[model samples]
Target: MGELKLMKGNEVIAEAAIRCGCDGYFGYPITPQSEIMEYLALREPWKETGMVFLQAESEVAAINMIYGGASCGKRVMTTSSSPGMSLMMEGLSYIAGAELPCVIVNIVRGGPGLGTIQPSQADYNQATKGGGHGDYQSIVLAPATVQEMYDFVELSFDLAFKYRIPAIILSDGVIGQMMEKVTLGEFKPRWTAEQIEQMSGSWATTGMKGRKMNVTTSLRLQSEDLEKHNNNLQAKYRTIEKEEVRFDEYMTDDAEYILVAYGSSARICHKTVELAREKGLKVGLLRPITVWPYPTKRLQELAQKAKGMMAVEMSAGQMFIDLKLAVNGKTPVEYYGRMGGMVPSPSEVLGALEKQLIGGANNE
Candidate 1:
């Protein structure tokens, strides 16, 4: 075990990055997520762990800095809110195209041109469907609690390096601002240059060092070469889909109806599950931890037995599309959401489920 302490979600992200042996953090400050960089600035891990922390002038600069660091096989990361993320999209595409391994955290707020500083999950489509232009995908992890907010940073780094791709921690303002007790993981020493060379020797642009000069770029002027590169990328994505789908289920054994959700909304829906069960409503909850490599297989199986499913979100039904596809029309799917930075309570969610799924089905 390690140190146990109560900390805010953004603070733990900074501490967890340090403990996970991250080489550097390059990010700009944005509302609902500015605390992440603020915490790092206050902690000043440069003196403690030799970690590099830079407050970039803009989100664009931060993401490009990530590209440079990751090219050297360093564990680099960046965090931002919705507008800031919009600024980073092109850089994100470049990083993905170059196949660099780095972690990016998006503590999402209400969107569509600075909608609100409060929480919203509207970025669900943006994160899972590759906000950047191209056929690439990032491993998108949705953390529902403060503990998960800390734990997923390390997991995101692990998966990013393992697959040689960018990984994203897709969180919302609620989780980012919440505080909870977390058991800190044991500190890990930053990797030495020699260790980086040994681990990433295959393609990392460390140096010539008596070998062929390594080149890392996404440019393939030749159409044939670009197509071949895309094929390789697709193959990698398939492997990830096969191995990385992660989700959690509650009270699903004899569930007649199901609720699908992620991130902060999932937390509310958990209580909704308990409340429904109290009313003798056989309702279960499916929370997708990784929203990109979604739990489609499990949802498909559940669809065969479930009378209906309702997707609860903080957006105007973005993830609802994925849920409908996952069930493949085997069962009726409904959507309930609150937009413009509004968060629905557990009772409200249960009421939506009752009105949209249960009562509607009974009427039929």
Candidate 2:
């Protein structure tokens, strides 16, 4: 084993980015996510390893800075909260349209115009459906715990670079601030020069006089060409759905009732599973790591074995819709959550599960 340390998820993200040979970080300070920037400033990875950390004037500027760094074939990332993430949507669309490879972490707080400083999963629809104006998709990776924050970031970097697309670590405030024992493996970068070159060769702004400047843009003058570009992006997304769906199964091998959750809520659901187990309830957890790709297939498979699932979240069951779709009316799928930073406790979830398990309440 490398080492074990109790650290917050935000701190681990900064360290992990540096260890992954991140060349730059461009971000605007935001609530519940400021610690990541503060941690990077104190650690000063830039001083030791030439890594650049730039606190931009705003989130828009920050994401554009990410675009600039990525243009140079450098591994770059940014971190912010929900409000800040909203500000970056325009740039996010541009980055996606230009086919750039970069990582963005949104330590989400309550949403819809500065809602709260506490944790929230309200950004699920925005993240999965593309908050920007254009038809774009961000590879959204959700981490359920501080440990997964570290583990998933490494994977996020790989996916971002692999797909020549902007990838997001769609985490929340609780996971960012919570301290947990984390094990980091040997530092190994997911990208090689050849890999970077391949991505850049596809769309990056390398040079001009060489080959008509190789415009990095998402615009096409002809409708047919624009349609072609959109079609290509859609195909890439389909590829991700096939290869990038990730989730965790617990007590699910023989589960009669399944709990569908993601991010920190799913971590809470795990404890709920333990309590349900002692009470002789056949419960299990399906924790989706990629919120956008949404492990619908795996959950559908579980639906075949379980009576139903209760979608858990810090928001008002924002993910329940996906669960219902996966279940396809074959089983009951309900909702259990609190909005504006109110997280359900293990006892609260247990009570809800008990009500459903006994009463068969399908609250839609």
Candidate 3:
């Protein structure tokens, strides 16, 4: 039987990593997110699963260690918040450049600088668009609850290993700190010795002999080869967009105004929906679960039926661009949000929606 309990989001992630058969975790402690490391350290996940947990010197070192582990085609992961995630961007760029498999969790905090320990969705651009200097993208998953915190981390690991690309979990303080019920799936062992031998035979860096020489570095000496690598990466991204888009739609069939948001902010939009209905307004919500894929198709489909969309967020308006791009100019995309650890209240979103229709200052 599966075990269900109220758990912290960070602890859920650490436990899920073990249950998912992740081979190793390398990360440094950062505020709000530090609990993730503490949980793993206390649990000693390695003892049960033959996993490895390394508390690296810094976020930079932690991600590089992830890089090293992933090169072996192993299931590896790491976690941090905004500022620390910024430190790992250099390594994130390298992981994407090399098309290696790894999972990263960013328990987002307000940012631009050290920001705050409180939750913020301001890293929308940093996680969606390549934050680091890169011509590559990571598959970004945004989880709004502790349940998704556990589940998305597992799925992100699977996607990372399956696609041989990086997977990122973008979450905020509301979800990270909120206690919620979650079911721990059955524990399973990682890749067997035979499986590892077969994988190592081809892609892994287990020493070059008895077959062809193996190379695991991201650098390309020849310009033509570099171009080929970049082109290949783009092709892979296109494939991912087609295959992995996910979102949730609420009461959108006969709606006149739509609310587009993701992560913890989407929950607040739920309340906004109810209030909008109390006022007899046709309001709905479109919450994107996968941030990188951006659910452009879903928003475009909603555009054909709805009048306009209010793009709500904890950031200024990052997801707004996505809503616009998704709708492809079919409707005006408006925005209302606050940053630096402030959770936009339900009333605030309702006010924005009301202002949009009455004041005519919004999507028109």
Model 2: worst 10 consecutive residues (lDDT sum): 204-213
How big is the positional error of residue 141 in model 2, measured in Å on the Cα after superposition? 1.1
Between candidates 1 and 3, the one scoring higher on TM-score is 1
Output the TM-score of candidate 1. 0.98
lDDT of 2 by residue, 86-169 (tens): 889998888888888889999989867989999999998878888898898989999988878888776877898789888899
Q: By TM-score, how accurate is candidate 2?
A: 0.94
Which sections of candidate 3 miss by over 4 Å? 357-359
For residues 1-364, write the lDDT of model 1, one tens digit per residue: 8888999998889999999999999999899998989998999999988999999999999999999999999999999999999999999899999999999999999978979999999998888888989988999999998889889999999999999999999998999999999889998999998999899977789998967888889999999999999999999999999999999998888999999999999999999999999999999999999999999999999999999998999999999999988899999999999998999999999998998888875332
Give the TM-scores of the predictions, in the order they appear: 0.98, 0.94, 0.97
Ranking by lDDT: 1, 3, 2
RMSD (Cα, Å) for all candidates, in order, is 1.2, 2.0, 1.4
Candidate 2, residue 351: lDDT = 95
Candidate 1 Cα misplacement greater than 4 A, ranges: 361-364
Q: Which stretches of candidate 2 lie over 4 Å from their true place?
A: 187-199, 208-212
Candidate 1 least-lDDT 10 residues: 355-364
* Tens-digit lDDT string for candidate 3 (1-364): 7899999998899999999899999999898888888998999987788889999999999999999988887889999999999999999999888788899999999877988999999998988998888688899999988999999988998788778889999998888888999988889789865686586557777666566776677799899999999899999999999999989988888888899989899999988999989988899998999999889888888888777888999998888878777888898778888889999899899998888753577645
